[model samples]
Target: MKVLVTGGAGFIASWCRRELTARGHSVLVMDHQDRRHQLADGEEFFLGDVRDATAVTEAAAHVDGIIHLAAVLGTQETISNPRPSAETNILGSLNVFEASTQYDLPVVYAGVGNHAFRLVGTGCYTITKSAAEDLARMYNLYREGGRVTIVRPVNAYGPGQSVAKPYGTSKVRKIAPAFACRALTGTDIEVYGDGAQISDCVYVEDVARAFVTALEHTAVHGPTERPVEVGPLESRTVNDIARLVAEYAAKVTGREPVGIVHLPMRPGEVPNAVVKSDTTTLQQIGMTVADFVPLEDGIARTVDYYNTEWLPGYLAA
Candidate 1:
C-alpha cells in the first residue's frame, strides 16, 4: 500500500513510518520539517503544512490511505496559544478528512486517549483533538464507503521526546521527559497535584503498531465505531513514575536518587485522568495487553536514552 502520512517527521510518526516500511508498504510523508534526507528508497517526503488545503490535497494524490498525526501539541502550549492549536488540530484535521473523502481513501487518525473524558473542561489540546475526532466520525458517517479509524494513545513516551523549556513558544512539557531529564542531572523531580493524578503511559513503538494494525483492519473490514484505545492495562500515578525515573537514573548514572517535589496542578489539565482501555476493540484488531511493553522496561529505556543521547547535547547547549 502507498500511504500518505501527515506529520511524518514527528516522534510517533517517525516510528509509524518505520513500521509501515517494515510491513512492505511505501510512504509519502507530509510535514513542515524537511526530513527528505531520512526517507528510504521507495518512500517520499513532501515539505508542507496540513493546514494548507492545497498542500493536503496534493499530498493525498496517489496514496491508498492517510495517517493523520500532525498537530500543535502540549496541554499548556495549546491553552496558552489556542489559535494555532485549533488551526492545526481542528482545521488541519478537517483538511485531511476532506482530502480523504475527495480521494476515496482510508484514514487512521491519531487521537488523545483521554479525549473521551477530557472534553468537558480540559485544555485546548484536548478540545481541539476531540473536535478532530468528531470530524473523523462525521466523515465516516456521511461519506459513502468511508474508512476512518481513530487510534487514541495515552501518554506515549520513548526516546527522542523533547525536554520542557521554561520559556518557549511551545511550552510542551511531557512527564516522562521532564522526570527523566531532571533525574539524570540529579535535580529534583517535580510532581504536580500532590502526585495523585494517574496516567497510562504507552510505548511509542506499541502505539505505532496499533496505528498500523488499525489501518490494516479499516482497509479490510471498514471503520469500527469505537476508537482503538492504545494503552497499557495498568495505570500509574505521577508519584510512581517520578520515583521510577529517579531510581532508574540513579542506577544508570551511579548517582544519588533525585527528590520528588510536589506542586499545585497546572491549569487546563484533568487532575484524575486515567485511560480505560477498550479491550474489545483491541481483541477485534488482534492485540492484547500482553503485547505492550512493561512500564519499568519502557521507562528504563527512556531514561537511558536521555542519559546517553539527550544529556550530552543538553549540557553542551
Candidate 2:
C-alpha cells in the first residue's frame, strides 16, 4: 500500500512512517515544514500545508490511504491562538476528507482521546479536534464505502518530542518533555494543580502501531463508528510522572533527584481529571494493552533522549 501521511515529520508520525515501511508499505509524506532528517530510499516527501485544499487534493491523488496527522498542537497554544489552530485542524481536516471522498481513499484520523470528550468549556485544541472527528464521521455517512477511522491517542510521549518555546515550535509545555528536561538539568520539576491530575501516557511507538492497525482494519473491513482509543492499561498522576522523571534522571546522569514545585493549574486545563483508553476496538484489531510499552521503560528512554540529544542541541544553539 502507498500511504499519504500528513505531518510525517512529527514525533508520532515519524514512528508511523517507519512502521508502515517495516510492514512493506510505501509512504508519501506531506508537511508544511521539512523537519525530517532524511527521506528513506524510495520514500516521497511533499512540501505542502494541509490548510491548502489544492495541496491536500494533489497529495491524495495517487495514495491508496491517508493517515491525516497534521495539526497545530498544544492546548494552551491553541487557546492563545485559536484562529490558526482552527484553520489548520478543522479546515485542514475538511480538505483531507473532501479529497479522500473525491479519490475514494481510506483515512485514519488522529483524534484526541482526553479532550474530545470535553465538549463544553474546553480549549481550542479540544474543540477543533472534536470537530475534525465529526467531519470524518460525516464523510463516512454520506460517501459509500467510506473508510475513515478515528484513532484517539492519550498523552503520547517519546524520544523525539520537542521542548516547547526557546527549544522548539510548541508554544505550550508538554508534561514529559518538561519534566525530563528539568530533571536532567537539575532544575525544579513543576507540577500543576496539586499534581493529582491523572493521564494515560502511551508510548509513541505503540500509538503509531495503533494508527497502522486502524488503517489496515479500515482497509479490510469498512469504517466503524467507535473511535479506537490507544493507550496503556495503567494511569499515572502528574506527581507520579514528575517523581519518576527525577528518579530516572538521577539514575541516568548520576545527579541527585530534583525538587518538584507545585503551581496553579493552567488555563483550559481541568484538575483531578483522569484520562484512560478504551481498547475494545483496538483489541478487535488484535492489539491488547499487554503490547504497550511499560511506563517506566518509556520514561527512561524519553529522559535519555533529552539528556543525549535534545538538551545538547538546545545548549549548542
Candidate 3:
C-alpha cells in the first residue's frame, strides 16, 4: 500500500514512516520540512506544506491511505499563536481529509488523549485539536470508497526530539530526550502545575505500529462503528516522568537524582485525565497495545539514544 504521512519529519510521524517502510509498504512523507527523519531507504518523498491544498490533493492522487500527524503541538506554543494553531490543526485536517475523499483513500488523523478527555493548562492547544476531532467526525461518512479513523494516543516519547535549546525557549526537539537531557544537565525539569496530573505515554515506536494495525483492520471503522482510541492501558504523572528522566540521567552520568520538586496545576487544568474511548472499536479491528515499555526503561533507552546518536549528530553540526 502507498501511504502519505504528513509531518513525516516530526518525532512520532518519523517512527510511523519507518514502521510502514519496514513492512514493505511504500511511504510518501509530505511535510513543509522537505525531510523525513529516520527515513527508510525504500520510502519515497514529497516536499510541500499540509496547509497547501494543492500539495495534499497531489499526494492523495497517488496514495492509498493517509496518516495526518502535522500540527503545531504544545500548549505554550499554541496559545501564544492561536490563529496559526487553529489553521494548522483544524483547517489542515479539512484540506487533507477532503482531498483524501476526492482521491478515494482512508485517512487516520492523530488524536491526542488530552483532546478527547481534558483541557488542562493546554489552553488553545486543546481547543484547536478538538476542532479537528470534530471535523474528522463530521467527515466520517459512507463515501464512495474512503474512510476516516481517529487515533487517540497518549503522550509519546522517543528519539527525534529537540529540547536542548535555552531556558524559556519553546523548542521541544524530542520529547523524551529533551526531558532526559535536561535532567542530566541538572536543569530543573518544569512541571506545569501540581505534578500529579497523569499522562499515558507509549513509546513512539509502539504508537507508530499501532497506527498501522489500525489501518489494516477495517473493523476499527466498524462499517457501523465511529470512534477509535489507541494507546497503552495505563498512565504516569508529570512528576512520575520527571523522576524517571532524573533516574535515567543519574544512571547514565552516575549522578544521584534527589527527587522532583512539587508544583501546582495551572488554571483551566484538567487533572486525573486519560482519553476514554470504546475499547471494542479497536478490539474489533484486532488492534491491541504491545511493547509496554516501563517509563523508566523507555527513558533509559531514550537517554542513551540521545547521548550516543542525537547529540553527536546535532552538536557536531
Per-model CA lDDT versus the true structure: 0.85, 0.86, 0.70
True-vs-predicted CA distance for residue 32, candidate 3, Å: 0.9
**Candidate 2 residue pairs that clash:** none
Show the colliding residue pairs in model 1.
none
Q: Give stretches of model 3 more than 4 Å off.
A: 36-39, 117-122, 167-175, 219-226, 263-281, 310-317
lDDT (C-alpha) at residue 23 in model 2 = 96
What is the Cα-based lDDT of residue 67 in candidate 2?
A: 94
Compose the digit string of candidate 1's lDDT tens values, residues 157-209. 99877677641122588888989988888899988787877877888999999
Candidate 2: which stretches are off by over 4 Å? 35-37, 166-169, 315-317
Task: Sort by TM-score, best first.
Answer: 2, 1, 3
Which lDDT tens digits does candidate 3 get at residues 113-186?
Answer: 67753333555767877778777766665455547777777677776555646522345333466576667666
**Candidate 3 weakest ten by summed lDDT:** 166-175
lDDT of 2 by residue, 67-152 (tens): 99998886766778899889999999999999988888888999997754455466788889989988888888887646799999
Which ten residues in a row are the worst by lDDT in model 2?
Answer: 113-122
- What TM-score should be assigned to candidate 1? 0.95
What is the clash count for each candidate, in the order shown?
Answer: 0, 0, 10
Name the better of 1 and 2 by lDDT: 2
